[model samples]
Target: MKVKEMIKENNRLREQMTPFNRSYLEDMILVLRASRVDPLRTEELLLEAAQQMLIAQKKGNTATQVFGDDPEAYFKEVIETTPSRPARSKLNYYLMIPWTALTLLFGVMAIVGLISEWTTGSAGMFGQISLFTLLSVGLGSIIFIEMIMKWMSSLSDTDAPRVGKFNIKGFGVYIAIAVVVIYAGLYLSQLFPPFALSPWVSLILSIAGLLGLKFIFLK
Candidate 1:
């Protein structure tokens, strides 16, 4: 066979291979379309495909001939043709659970303090004022918590359950802290009045109460 004829034959085969390479690239794009993952995630995939296309072009394969030797062009086309990404929801309200729980739990504690003062008849004007403030703050906090819980319940089922549990647990923790603090305060006050609270006995009792709470919490 003549050398010129052999070269022509080679050229024809290369042209025929182009369509087959193009079809594979088309198939890849189709497979990517079928994927359930978000389109934004496809950026990396498109980049990889572009690199492969560039390599195929350099290798002088039929695939590169149809898609072109320029991987950047294919990457740009994929990016432009990609589906619009969905907007992410900002459910930051879930973050309010712990704060809500603390407020409600502390508010109830304040109301209890007020009642205790009233029953003992030892509360002066300042004490009454403090108690009233506590009662108001606590009641307001409870109302706020109820509102938050209702709103959360109406949104996501999974998130609502988790947030609800967090609020409950936080409230329980606050109550436990309150009980420990109150008991220690009462015990120390009985042993040493405020005027004489600087005494060694009062200091020891106060430290003992704190250490006891630490032990209880650890257990």
Candidate 2:
């Protein structure tokens, strides 16, 4: 089945679970997504789990009975046993993430620049973008992913997952480091020989990039 269809089916079935079972399933969803398993594999695994839970529910077995009380332990086994994506697929996913980030970042700046130039006759958000700016976005994506996984790590023990589960102190420290990374990127860009992109050119590159992501890397 298509990933979307599997997900739709899973959702429709999971709703039949008891309140306790449903909450446990929701926690599983959070941990599964945060685990960074392959997207299609993740959905398939989820649908299977949902199907099992439904069958067990009819037999009067709670989620904890069939799937173990500790989600931490159950999913640890599942994720470990799950095969890793092929090296090439892994490379493509990583490359796609950064490329998507880069194009979207510059695309927004391009639009803002065009608007500013139209009204005030001066360059907008950025006068020039540098190679270091690309480095920053790439690093930022990695950092963002690490932060997310770190937070999700705590959800394994919780009965239900929610935003309140995030650690405030950890988030504060992460935000500080992120602030430093942003300034550091801006400063490093000043050290490089930067080139200007006319608003039209920037916009065209952004559009072309989205097309490339949509077609060539169509995975």
The digit string of per-residue lDDT tens for model 1 on 29-136 reads 444443443444553464455455556766775554545554335456555666554432112223233334434444444455456557874333323223233333
TM-score of each: 0.20, 0.70
Best by lDDT: 2
State each model's CA lDDT, in order: 0.44, 0.77
Q: Considering only N, C-alpha and C atoms within 3 Å, which residue pairs clash in candidate 2?
A: none
Clash pairs detected, candidate 1: 21-63, 107-138
How big is the RMSD of model 2? 4.2
Which stretches of model 1 miss by more than 4 angstroms? 1-17, 62-219
For TM-score, the strongest prediction is 2
* Tens digits of lDDT, candidate 2, 33-146: 656577788888888888899999999998889889876567787688777666877677678777788888779878988888988997754657776777878768866866
Reference-based lDDT, residue 167, model 2: 77
Query: Model 2: residues >4 Å from true position, as ranges?
Result: 14-23, 26-42, 55-61, 72-84, 159-187, 216-218
Cα displacement (Å) at residue 111, model 2: 1.9
